[model samples]
Target: MTPKAILLHLRLPFSLFLMPVYWFSISQSPHFDVTKACWVFVIWHVLVYPASNAYNSYFDKDEGSIGGLEKPPAVDKELFTVAWAMDILAIVLSYFFVGAVFALAVLVYGLVSKSYSHTSIRLKKYPLLSWFIVGLFQGFFVYLSTQQAVLHPYNSLTNNLLPAILSSMMLWAVYPMTQIYQHEEDAKRGDRTLSLLLGIRGTFFFTASIYSLTALCFWVYLPLQQFLLFIVLTSPTLVFFLNWFRKTWLDASQANFKNTMWLNLLASFGLNALFITLLILQK
Candidate 1:
């Protein structure tokens, strides 16, 4: 595959949205191991994430719109086959690094991701279900799976329940922003997205309110030591709310979309990086 195609498939920018939960796991663990963290990151980033993107691209024929891609890099007709191969390879390899259960999670996520955009069961056409599934899987499942894999035998869903739920809530808050921005295009394509159902005015309010609530939850749920750091890192999310709730909110310009997107991404990335750095320093 071409280098550009590979990079596009990696979707590094989009990965920012999920980093908080991964870092949360690291911060909360007393025996955080960098080696296992690296392995899980690779499985999630290098293989699982890329394969999901590439597979979605192949079937969506979105003219490259889905998965935060625009003008997607061209690929061979066998791209779908290659995507599936990569996914299976990643799942198999997960057993070696994170154990059988974690590997099974990979397989489950792989199937779910495939069904998301696959022609036979295109979940993307149903906006609410699509958003919910993507949020739950990419947000909650990624966090849970990463934590379980990294923490190994000691980790249990019971122990990691709070972080997993918070992660899911965080993504659920931001997921509507993507749907709002894509409303026009999706509606034109006969896709009944939640944002389209909300309409522009309603969508703006919905996204702003959800984002605000997520920020509040972050403040309430973070550890005492992390409160100040979280605030400093994630404050820009408020700007998104302000801009989104402006009186002239009907102007769904590219600049507006990019501003909200980048702001939210920065909030997530900064929080994750801060949490990870603190964990490392403490260890």
Candidate 2:
């Protein structure tokens, strides 16, 4: 109920984890209204993502570590209040500034994120279902939303399917990694994350397989030089992931918060770097 707990539970830092989707979405537009893009950024990162984090925290009330928070605060009613406040603000902002299509997208995204953690229909309990949903909404849905926000005459997904699909794949890569370190907490909450079902080694194998295929698709989709630059930009993430994978292969215990956070942050950074470069180059 305290201000500190409420603020920490908001998990605004975790918004960085999802920023690549927004960046990649805009990068595809070639040209966009900068003011609209900035508003979309504030709507998604400042309001929607933090609200989702707080809402999920309110429901889970985790005693152990969760993504972006190694020592989570005790969730209270105030957290729930703050989450709704933010969600309303996001929706209102989208409605006024971003347009109806984007506003509706925000509404749906918020509701779906709420459903992910709500007891009424906690989607997190179903490993594959939850995994797919996270990838779909956070990935494809976000790409769509970003396009809605920035494009003057929004382009249809029919044309931009590859990057939109890749956005989901990027999130799919992130989803399991976030759960790998939360096995006990997730299990305690009766949530069977894809990571738990795969087992520690299996989780890494599955992630590597998915990431490999995703990267191959990106390579095929991007121009030769762009893809090469992508590899260079993302090399640090790939290197760290491989090193972490090797360590976790030797000892599952290595898949702890410190390692998982580094993976998430580094991966986000690398992807953000690549997409932002593409965005700049497009201009």
Candidate 3:
């Protein structure tokens, strides 16, 4: 396969959406080791991500999902077969590095991701459930597994757990914006996601309420120094979020879609950078 085709198949940029959360969890854990972090990062980015993307592309047929390949060229049967083979290989190999517990985490996430796209189980058809599962896995599970892999015998939650959890909650809060952007196509495809179930105003209310709750949770859980750093790092994106909320949610347009994508990246990156900085300083 061509290099460009390989990249499209792997969906590299989409991995950015999850990497920060994973890294932060690794950095903040009490038992964290930089070496473990490196291994976990490589495993997820090289193995898990490509497997998930290959499976998603094969089933979802999301030809136009921005940040993903549109009309991804058809994979030959050999490629499809190889992808699945790698999926199993990656998850199994993870156990040697992350321990059996971490291996289970990979199994659970892999199953959920597969069900979301493949078969009649199509989890994406249900709005609230879809977002919840996506958030739970992408937001929470990624960190949980990474933490386990990097810091296997920790006694309590990692220092980074609170921050990562809070950040994940933030992503969950705004996930509807993404759903809203795809409503027209989704409805035509007979997918009734959370945005459709809640309606426009309701989506705004749901997202905003969650965002506020995340902020409150962060204040309560994070150390003052960390909290201040987080707030400072995330300020510009948070301001954008506020501005986006002040406007109408009823109109889901191309401009709004672009803005949402921008904000999502900003928020994820901002949170990631904060924790990584903390790791460096602490070291």
Candidate 4:
């Protein structure tokens, strides 16, 4: 693959979603090591996420738009090689920066991510299972991993379980929405994405319902001031969501790639800002 192809395969922009998890975990952590934390970020964003994206792109070979790229380039043998190489490097660096346990977690995350698109295993073919796995790994697993990486010698697995679960719930809510605009492409590949299984209207309702639940969890877990701040930060995206849902309801064409990309960018940036603000306030 050419350099452009390699960058396209990485889908680096999509890491915006993953990046917030680190901030959220570190905000809650009592112990912080800047060097270890920076290494963890590099391992996940530069290595683990890109590996997963490149591997999926290799399997899908999508001619149409894929996540984070509306016009993806053609893939070649080099894409697959680079992806697995990154995965191995991530695991190795995980061991060096964190410990054997965290390294093992990264290994398992890589395997599961590969299974999602691998022809033989193809976990993406199962809608519910695919949704659950992605939400679990990308949300809860990542949050805990970052937490552990930062607080390695001090904190236990249960230290921040509530926030991790809330993070996973939020991801579950948004996960299907990400798949909404890919119904045709996913169906062509025999992948029954969760959005397709839910249908467009059902997908919206599912997302809204889970988002409400996540909000409730935040209210319970966060201080009144912090929860209020969270609401204020998220209101703009919530309004945008309502507008987009209304437009899509009127005309399905409104649910195209351009609109979905806008939503992802808006929501991810909003959440990233919110988490960073929370981190600052905590400090």
- Per-prediction TM-score to the true structure, in the order listed: 0.87, 0.98, 0.86, 0.97
- Per-model lDDT: 0.72, 0.91, 0.72, 0.87
Best by TM-score: 2
lDDT of 1 by residue, 1-283 (tens): 6766766765666766666767776777777567888888878877887788778767755552444565567666567877888888898888987689889999999999999776678787887798789888987788877777777355767877776777777777766666666666666667777677877667667766776776677677776667777677666666656665673365556424555566566667777777787787668
Q: Candidate 4, which ten residues in sequence have the lowest lDDT sum?
A: 150-159
Predicted candidate 2 versus true structure: per-residue lDDT over 58-78, tens digit per residue? 999999888899999787788
Residue pairs with clashing backbones, model 1: none
- lDDT (Cα, 0-100) at 18 in candidate 1: 64
What TM-score does prediction 2 earn?
A: 0.98
- Best-to-worst order by TM-score is 2, 4, 1, 3
- Report residue 91 deviation for candidate 1 (angstroms): 1.1
Residue ranges of candidate 1 with Cα displaced over 4 Å: 1-3, 64-67, 73-76, 247-250, 254-257
Per-residue lDDT of 25 in model 1: 66
lDDT of 3 by residue, 154-205 (tens): 5455545676576579669867866655666678778888887887667778
Best by lDDT: 2
Query: What's model 1's lDDT at 29?
Result: 70
For candidate 4, give the lDDT.
0.87
Clashing pairs in 3: 127-193, 127-194
